[model samples]
Target: MHKIIVTGLTGFVGTNLKKYLSSYEIESLSVRYIPNQKIEINADAIIHLAGKAHDLKKVSRPNDYYEANFELTKQIFDSFLKSKATVFIFMSTVKAVADKVDGILTEDTVPNPKTHYGIAKQQAEEYVLGRKLPEGKRVYILRPCMIHGPENKGNLNLLYQLVAKGLPWPLAAFQNKRSFLSIENLCFLIKNLIENKMVVSGVYNCADDEVLSTNELVQIISLALKRKSRSIAVPKSIISTIAKIGDIIRFPLNSETIQKLTENYEVSNKKIKTALEIEKLPHTAQYGLERTIKSFINK
Candidate 1:
């Protein structure tokens, strides 16, 4: 049996990946307690998904991100290299490339991580890349854009909440293209990377077939929830001023939140698609987002 070990199994992406690949002999285990090599010694492959994600609340320490995202990954990668595991997949983030991409983000972009979270993941990627790999054993550092799936509570949820309340989407004036990866497509790429030994070791950015603007996202959410999307073109200046105030009031509609929603974070999936020999992602970006919005709205 081809057994696979996945860390951070309880997270949104890990949980969804498990549900998607239920037929595979997969085990979700914690890496903090169990030593890395001890757990991975006998496994066929390891998917390093456990990490301290970016703290939106700004409550976590700087070392926390480095240790959890970078150090823990280093431990696992070292173990996988020594073990029988033929493949290792580390779930990184597109943020490792840049905080604000001037144009479309692809695998070729030089990394300039602005946040501690991005820097940590980038360091982890560098650690793996610097190593001399054993023959036939490959490492993949995957940088995926915002991932959405069942029970996910992030920007998608915020959008869902706005649309579900039948409130006017007042921030449609800031139209920008952003890329999103569905949990389904991510699992597909991971499965292929594990089963196929021919895949070369390096970083790959994953995303759905197309990019969508915030307005388009609202439209999709509205359609999915069977509600009318009432959008108002609130002046960007006024909205920005309100968002600035929101920062002091601890309102959810702060400048940072607004920028994240409106900013362009496009990533290219060309490398992944070429590797999989597929013309397009199996599931449409809106399909996954729509499903998730409806799932949480009904809940």
Candidate 2:
């Protein structure tokens, strides 16, 4: 069995990835923020998931992103270069490229990250891609967008709570399509990358086959809860005014949240699908959302 060394083992993605790789012997590494620290990497493959996540509240310091995402990644990657580990998988984000996608985001999109979190991740990606690897080593930089699964307390969780309470979705007037990543599909790809030597080493965008609107997501959540979806097509101008007021008082329906709800951030997974030699993802968009909503309901 291939022994895998994983960082961020306690995180949502790491935990799910470890569980999915049940046949492999997985070891979790404890990482510190000290720069130039010597990391001990003794394994056949290394899955680097450890990084400072994007803070929606915008309360984190700029240096915190650099220390946790960029500096720590540089430190671990340096160690991987010298170690015998043949495969190195880094968990980068679509945020590293662009905060808002004008069109369907592809691997070739030129990155212009605005946030400190994204800038740090981009730096880490650059460091990994700029290195010259040994003959037997392979490196993969995966850029995943809006990952959702069980126990994820993200924007989806808030929507789940709203639908659970039988509240009407008010932003049905704004139509937008967004890409989402299923935890199961992500794990499948990671397993394939580890076992399949045919996949070329490079940057790949990871997402589900289909893109769905937020209104569609509301329907899915309602279906999972066995309830009727009440969608209200409130005027866009009216919603904007309310969001402006919300910004002043720091309410739930603020400008940022409004943009997130109504943004068209679609990502293309054609590159990864072609590399994996697969036609469709393991789970459909509605099916994956239903599974995630069911987990929230069960809890």
Candidate 3:
């Protein structure tokens, strides 16, 4: 049995990953963000999932990102380099590369992170990649896009609630394609990496096979809920003005939320898929979105 030590074991991705890796012997590590905190690294595989997620509320301190994402990763990775752990999986984000994707986001894209959260993770990625590795040990930095699953309420949930209440989606004029990562697909990729001895160790973009626009997502929610989804083609300029006002008034549909809802952030998963020697992921984008939408109904 492969013994794994998982940080952030209770998080959305971590919890789902643990359930997927139920056959393995898993140990959870709880590390405080205090200075010089100790990390125990005794396992065949070390999956680092804990980090300060991007605060959409914008209330977090700047140092909090460095301490939680960069410093903590440095400490744990230092221990991993010296320990018997054969594989190290770091859960990075595509935002570390770019906040807005012009076309498809690939591994070759130069990183220019605009947020402290992205900058800190980029720092951690640099720390891991800069180090000279031992002959047997492998390191993998996974850059996943927006990940959604059952029971986790993210922006998708907000859309679901709006659709459930029969509210028309007002931003149909915003035409954009965004990539998403399903938790099941993420676990599948991680498991393949852990079990396959020949897969190369490097940064890989993790995302679903298909890209969906927000307008299409509304339709999917409607299909799942058995409702006729209504979408309004509101003018983009008007929406932008409203979002700017929302930024000042702290409305739900602020500039950031608007960008999040309508941005073209498509990520390419070709690198990881090639490494796994697979043509398609286990779950399709529609299948995963439907599953997640249905879960909201039961809640």
Q: 1 or 3, which is superior by lDDT? A: 3
Instruction: Give a tens-digit lDDT track for model 2, residues 1-299.
Output: 28999999999999999999999999999896895578999999999999889987789999999999999999998999999899999999999999999989999999999999999999999999999988978899999999988888688977888889989999999999999999999999999999988888899999988999999999999989999999999999999999999989968898988999899999999999999889998898777788888889888
Per-model tally of clashing residue pairs: 0, 0, 0
lDDT of 1 by residue, 2-119 (tens): 7888999989888888887787888876876333445455688788899998888799999888888888888888888989888889999998989998789999999999999999
lDDT of 2 at 281: 89
Positional deviation of residue 169's Cα in model 2 after best superposition, in angstroms: 0.9
Candidate 3 lDDT, tens digit per residue, 128-171? 99999999988999999989888877889779988999999999
Q: RMSD, each candidate, Å?
A: 1.8, 0.9, 1.3
The TM-scores of all predictions, comma-separated, are 0.95, 0.98, 0.96
lDDT of all predictions, in order shown?
A: 0.86, 0.92, 0.92
Q: Candidate 1: misplaced stretches above 4 Å?
A: 33-40
Q: Which stretches of candidate 2 lie over 4 Å from their true place?
A: none
Better of 1 and 3 by TM-score: 3
Sort all candidates by TM-score, best to worst: 2, 3, 1
* Alpha-carbon lDDT of model 2: 0.92
Q: Number of the top candidate by TM-score?
A: 2
